[model samples]
Target: MVLIGYWLIEKLFTFEAYKTRNNRGFIIRQITHHKTKQEKERQREKLINMEKRVLYGLVVMLMYLVGGGYSQGVVEWIRDKAEWEEILVKTEIHIGVMVTSPLCGAPCDIVNDQVARFVETYGDRIKFYKINVLETLFFALDYKILTVPTVIIFKEGTINLRFESLSDWGMFYELLVNSSILDFPPDLSPAPAPAPSDSDPDADLPPPLQSGE
Candidate 1:
């Protein structure tokens, strides 16, 4: 009653099944190639992102060198008796002892930068001076600056506060607020600057005198 012709069945098999089976390998290869291309594209994007980050950091450094974030020439370096006299006689002054030697590591440089950056705004009201211990070791010894990065505050021509190895802005802020000296940023505090152990110029100095001598 219902017998399909062999010729018609052969025609359908050749058009649909045979053709699809013949193209299956090519289709599989195309899919594999597209997957590989997508993976390569992802890797390329990641590499580009990494390069952009590095470039952005370089741009920031260049801008800073050109006086981008803060104004330059505010913090003066102290290296002579005349300069010391000026700071000493000033009504309000901040003297920072910093290490400028090539061997100075992260901690020393960080503390030095903290003071230098802070002086951008405060320098107008109060004088600020930086003493490089490597250049002028005598000043460090005279001021008892055993720490590589110590900040000594002078108000009314007298030593007001001595911050030894000053690490963060919290202690500096609190002290200044209590003394009514400097109004520093409260929430924008940076990471504490610790004393570098191995490569500090201050380490070569004679050990601190024992108590009750």
Candidate 2:
């Protein structure tokens, strides 16, 4: 039975790898056909790098599976290292919404909606990320997340604010405003005209003559 399972796993991975190779070849052909000499060389280099990354990923997965999950420690270590690297190296202010699956009901739904709106509103200024706790337990544990629909804001590689079970958009907005992470939505109203100053020679000039005067 174990041997059969291993064979099945190998076949599955082989099929996936074959598909990936076909796709990669097609993309490379297209790149070569369209690009000039310099661009073609650069693009081919990039494709080769991408292929290496994909192959490395597959090898890592096969090793894990073939070894009967013996690579679990190595995988965890890599994940932790990558997480810390991201936290420390990223320059943008990060807003992470941690939620359970969509099937978790009303709270998750609310969080999803609010997170979408928040991203749409402030996406240019902040980096927004969503973590599904059910799918990514490593992130949940790393962030010490204990509740569903938790929101965490990170500034300068440190946790700035964390709120659990947030359901109200208004309250969340207020928190962001109060914490000075985000300024209140700019008043779309036009700025008042500056008071005329003695130094403004242009203002003293009479309005330009209208055409056909």
Candidate 3:
């Protein structure tokens, strides 16, 4: 009876040892799996952070490029401001003197047309002021303009050139050209004659009847 009891106890203790070993193996596997999952999560977080940093850097670089281009454009535009201002001021004042009475007819019209042409041609370089003789007799007398259409080129608030009747474009152009106000030469060529065509009636005119024997 004692031997039988001792054998049964030994068998039970061996079975209990096998169960304990298996439980220990399962606990070790669970710990290893948990560690692997934690490591993967940490790597994913690092990659996301890296991507964010790269995106931020790109945004900063783009902003700098835009800002720098804008600054350069603004600087260039400001650089031309002074030259434009000087041109505006000079163009507001022009080269003309007051004309007084004893002036009328074709001469008056010619002078007015000349002044208008001067304004058209040199509008960018000079100003035009017209003082009619009948209207501004006092001013014409003050300038001692005995002639009907007298011109005075004013520079720096002083008289530069005084000339009588600009009867032709050449005469006026010469006045400014000699004084350095007109830098370029004017066109002086005569117009060309029209070409003959078969469709023209004059071209188809019959020759005079023969009279010679």
What tens-digit string does per-residue lDDT give for candidate 1 at 81-175?
Answer: 67677667764444433434445444444444455565664555456667777777777767776665566777676676777654443244345
Q: Candidate 1: deviation at residue 34, Å?
A: 58
Return the clash pairs for model 1, or none.
Answer: none
| TM-score of predicted structure 3 | 0.37
Q: Can you give the TM-score per candidate against the true fold?
A: 0.44, 0.43, 0.37
Candidate 2 residue spans exceeding 4 A from truth: 1-88, 167-170, 183-213
Score each candidate by Cα lDDT. Answer: 0.61, 0.61, 0.56
By TM-score, rank the candidates, best first: 1, 2, 3
**Candidate 3 lDDT, 1-213, residue by residue in tens:** 899999999999999999999999999999999999999999999999677556545544554465331121111111233543453356445445435245444444444444555555566555645556565545556577777666666655567667775534224544554565565455679989876685876775688898888
Model 3 residue 79 lDDT? Answer: 23
| 2 versus 3: better TM-score goes to | 2
Find the 10 residues in a row with the least total lDDT in model 3: 69-78
Q: What TM-score does candidate 2 reach?
A: 0.43
Model 3 bad stretches (over 4 Å): 1-94, 98-102, 165-170, 183-213
